[model samples]
Target: MNPWALSGVVLVAAVTFYLGKRSSRYANTTHDFLVARRTVRSRRNAAAISGEYLSAASFLGVAGVVLKEGADALWYPIGFTAGYLALMLFVAAPLRRSGAYTLPDFMEARLASEPLRKLCTVAVVAIGVLYMLPQLQGAGLALEAVMPAPAWLGAVGVTVLVTVNVMAGGMRAITVVQAFQYWLKLFALAAPTFVLCVVFFGTGGAGSAGSLGDPAPPVFREDTTVTVETGASFEVSEETPVWLPAEEGGQRVWLPGVRYEVDEGTTLRFPEGAPVPAVSGGEMDNASWLRPAEDAGALLGTYSLIFATFLGTMGLPHVLVRFYTNPDGKAARRTTVQVLVLLGLFYMFPVLIGALSRMYVPELLVTGRTDAAVLLVPSAMLPGVPGQILGAVTAAGAFAAFLSTSSGLLVSVAGVVATDVLAGKVRDFRIATVTMAALPAALAVSLPVEDLSLSVGLSFALAASTFCPLLVLGIWWRRLTWPGAMVGMCVGGGLVLLALVLNVLSEYSGGWAPWFIEQPALLTVTAAFLATIVVSLGTARRIPDDVNAVMLRLHAPDPLGFMRDRAEARFGRIEDRSRKRGKHRK
Candidate 1:
């Protein structure tokens, strides 16, 4: 009743997943534990990627931005989906071809140096930790909003649950779980959206809607108003207050201050004490960009979001690691495409829900929890038992979102920790998994003080700074030596660390700050890419010939040895047919 949908969703999610624990036993071998035994089909793997990729930021945060900013919110989803396309075109096949379990493994082989490997390992762990914090914080926020639980309880519960699942099952277990969670998230969002749309328009189609007459025009329900003292001498009553109450549910709901609509470039200000007015179609442009500071930016915001999404996907260790789960490079490529389509389809609903919320759940604006827009939209739009059922579905979706992404992040971290930290040193893989998973829980406790999305964005920027350069160069450039990789990682990683430090100090010290958030990714990534390239070019003479052969093996399916045999088995038949054809022609 009090917007406890998030808590109910999280509880149901934990229980559903807990009951499904036996499924984790499927991951038995190191390969299975690391990459789901490299047998994940294209469609399912794609869905899983899309599932994990669509975090709370996309589902809830972006939509809230749209409610406040208008068209700009559309960019978050567009950029996210398009990023998968980039993965499909550039990174997917090559990454799979690398035949490495973790990014560190790939770095070790490519750079042929332990130091580079260590750098990669540290970066992987750092990025994973950074990424995990938001999911935990969002989980806490979701739980607190949905249930009567303390925010920290949500974080603790999710961290523990995710740690257990990831450590117990590893990649093998998480693959299945993420896949199931993806469909669950889609269903949860889709089911509620469909019902809400019906409730919004009643039995009639869009043209016969009750609220705004034919093809209901979007309306704003103001929660708080800002009163500006212009110091103009005028009659108080005749001078109309900038904001006014609109009759809704038999009460005059008013916003306190001057409200202006930004239709294209025109500003339509509602004079003080005027009744809140509804604008149709073209007229709604006045209020467009003036609603909130977060929403007042331009399309550049979308492009920035997209840049982060597309590049960020390549840098995400969990998403990249999934490429290893494919049977071969081709399957990996196929999986990326599948993920793109699924991600695109799933995104459409959130944008709609957020847009719809602009009209119905405007109360969230007053409540200081616009992030809860996704969960609250269904309840606010659809009344009675139907609304309750829809609310449960939305809760389930949000829970699935947290669970899937959190599971993937934890699995990626555990993999890096096991292979790099505890490899050969730890007697048991299970023990290693537990240790790796628990460390992030400690980090999650410190996240609430920061912005969750920005934390994730910084993780992306850092990721782009370090890995994006490392990956593109590793795959495309042949001259990259160990020294190049090591130096490049340091340059990129250092920049990211520096940006983060500056941001923290600025917040703590209250001083003028640098362009830490705005351009960190662009600068760090460029420097790292350039450093790697220049260093590799300088050391080209010492480049080994073995690299070509290894790369060939990485890219092409050899009949005798593909990932210890799987790739070649499929290609072996093709080679045999060619030989037979030659024999027949002779």
Candidate 2:
């Protein structure tokens, strides 16, 4: 057990507790809990949004994917940051101008349909839960790397801490905590990265790794010994010499390059600059790893991934809720601009870490545990105390990613449950938080873990299919009717939901799941747009009576006082400006 890593994680938890406790007093109303009373300024709101946006996927999964898939994995971070562009261009200011606390609130207010609102409420919770699974998976990986504990303990720890924080002060407390976490995360990743780059490059270690364009697979930077903890099978492209463990007679042998299956507890030692073995006998090849595959299915999946991320940002419930905390439409827009800059800055560091890990931690590739690339890189590159300290910093950053994103998502889910299912009061919100968090927490512990980035992609594809079309058309198109919007959402959302269910079944049943089922974003998003347009045109006469008024409000400046209807009929006490305030003689 590394004391440095454990202490770093504990320190981060202590800080989170302190911040959440300090902000607990001000969350006195639903508005404060749901939207921070719409009083957060642009700069701080941007930091919180970026903080929550950079989840487990960004911190750990991206690096892992890069280590496994090479250049193709670069698309994940690119898509993640680019998604914000869609929000800024189409959704941000208009959604904030609508003055709604949640997605369901907007649906009911925009179309004047309670049924549509309820439909969206279900969708929000589904997306929130799906998104949370990956965060917990990442949390587990981080803790398990540094300490001798079961992976489920890390999952439960994150779930419990986030639930307590969200239940304590809701969005008001989360805002401050998330913003602070963003800076800490930035420092944690940045400081170690600076040192790693300087030491590795300045000390002439760079020349041994070779270029990305090198035809041969990556080589071990130095003589290294590795043992398979579970089991792994990998292929070699060239004859390689490996020294077996002492129990296996401790002899070195030249094995022909072929698919070799290894049992658990197998250990091997490779000499310095030896070519790394290829896993799955495909992308691990140096040139193949650097370029896109030529297969049609692979091409289609890539497009789906790009669309899922590019269009999915505006649709994410947790991300969308941050905009509502902005005081006005302009602030929301400004905050998005700032978020774009912050996110772009943070993504490059993880990419560098992944690239470096390829040379230093080549054994992870053979073992199919590339997700540990980021956590292991610092130690693999630098040995002993210095490496442990840097690894601890990274583990802390990973925790930040888990807690911030999980808290934001839990709050969003709880708010939906409180407003849609319960009495929509502060008390209901508190109860809903605990209730909403419980199911995901249990599932995170019991369910088998998945690749964090891929799991997050499932949520993005679902969001893109369902909410992206609704927000874009709802704000811009005056001819949109409630029936049309409902049908479109059902068609698009239903496909993705079905895909998710089938994907889950395939895991247990050993059935073949197609690429489209795993990544339906491109197809579903197009179907949603087409369905919404066709259905609306057919039902043009059924448009809302106040369509023009709503459109004007969505587009007009906030100071004009025509920005929105708050839909208080369902979610009462969201804001009560006429209520008396406590006064004192000054």
Candidate 3:
């Protein structure tokens, strides 16, 4: 364990806690706690939004995916950023104009149906919890890399910190803390990248010489030791010597064309320039890794991934909640634009880091823990005090990623639970915070750590399947009725949920099922949209009586004189009535 890295991460957590405490002063009211009284400026709100949106997937998983899958993985970052563009164009302004604090609030107000509201609240909590698992797992993985701690420790520790921050100041505090974290994350990634680039170029840039997809397999650049944490079977491309567990015998010479099983906790020492063995997942040469899909099935998977990510952003509960913080519709649009720029800038570093890891850290491939590339690569490349400092910087950034995203998710899920399940009050919010945080933290520890990016992508697929249709139809299609929205959410969410269950089971069944399970969004998203439209059109006569008024409120800019006058008149009448009652009583 490196003390400097540990201290740096601790310091970041402390500072985040302090910031949350300081922001608590502004969160006295329920409105403030839920939406910061809708007063956040665009730039700061954008930062907070970006910070929360860039979860474990962006901070760590992207690089790992890129390292293992090569150019194909680049789609993760591109789709992530493009999703915001889709949001800006379609959902941002109108969602903010809806004057709703959460998705359930929007559903209730828009559809004027309590049942629909309850359904949406359930979906929000489900998506939030699913989305949070990867963040927790990423935290555990990062901490384990830097310190001698069980994987669950990091998950539990982060959950506690996030809970405190959320309970302390709610949305107001989370906004301030998350905004700061965006820059911290940016600096943490950018600085190490700059240094690593210098180191790479200074050493003749040989790392960049070959295509990552070259048919030739990767080889160790130096003598190396790799300990398998999980038992895996791998193929030997050439004859090689490997150390074995005591029970298996001291050392054995592995031969070409044979598969060998490496048990958990088994350590293998490889000589310099030896070819890295390919695991059971199948090996990719630089050529295959860098190339786009060469087959129809691969092409389908790529498109499905793109479709899910591009459409999924607007549906993320945590991200959509951030729009509520903006002062107005225009501010919401501005916030999204700013988010695009910030996200684009921050995503560049992770891909580079992943590429570098392929050359410097091939052992990660053998271990099947490529997600650790960002956290492990710096120290591997630079080794010594400088490397430790860089690693510390990366570690701090990673923890910040977990903290910011987890806090935002907690706030979103807790708000839904408080309003829908518990009483909608500050005390209830606190209680809901604890419940929401605990459930996911427990799951994070209990569930096997699957591919971080893939897990998150499943969350995205769910969101895209369920909420994407509701929001799109809700905003643009006036024929949508309460029953239509409810059915759409249920059917769409239900199908995706079914797909998710089948996906888990398919892992055991094996065969062609895994491919469809891995990317359900292509079919599920279309089903959702079709169901929503058909049901909505069929139930056109059941549209709410005040549909015109609601549409005006959602589509019109907030500065319109009549809308302002109407709001003032309503509040003014309430105040006058209160004063008259007071005088009569006296």
Off by over 4 Å in 2: 206-213, 220-233, 240-274, 501-514, 565-586
Off by over 4 Å in 3: 205-215, 231-266, 509-514, 561-586
Q: For model 2, what is the alpha-carbon lDDT of residue 568?
A: 59
Candidate whose TM-score is highest: 3
List, residue by residue over 170-244, the lDDT tens digit for candidate 3.
998888899999999999999999999999878865643233545776777777788887766777666766666
Cα lDDT listed for each candidate:
0.65, 0.84, 0.84
Writing each residue's lDDT as its tens digit, candidate 2 over 361-401 gives 87787666677888888887788999999999999988999
What is the C-alpha lDDT profile of model 1 across 1-586, one tens digit per residue?
A: 4444654575666664663376564444465567765667888788778778778776666666565455655666776677777778777887777777788888776667777788888888888877877777777777765667777776787777777777666776777677778888888888778877876668443321123322322333433342221111111111223322332122323332333222222212343223323221112322443232243232333444555666877988988989887777888888887887788789888877866776665434323355777877766666566676677777777777777888888778777777777752223456766666567666666644343455677777777778887887777777778777777878988987887788777645533464434436656777888888888788887565668865675666634464432223312332343344331100
lDDT of 3 at 548: 90
TM-score of each: 0.79, 0.91, 0.92
- The TM-score of predicted model 1 comes to 0.79
Stretches off by above 4 angstroms in model 1 are 1-11, 14-20, 203-286, 290-303, 424-428, 449-451, 504-516, 557-586
How far residue 105's Cα lies from its native spot in candidate 2, in Å, is 0.7
Report, for all candidates in order, the number of backbone clashes.
Answer: 21, 0, 5
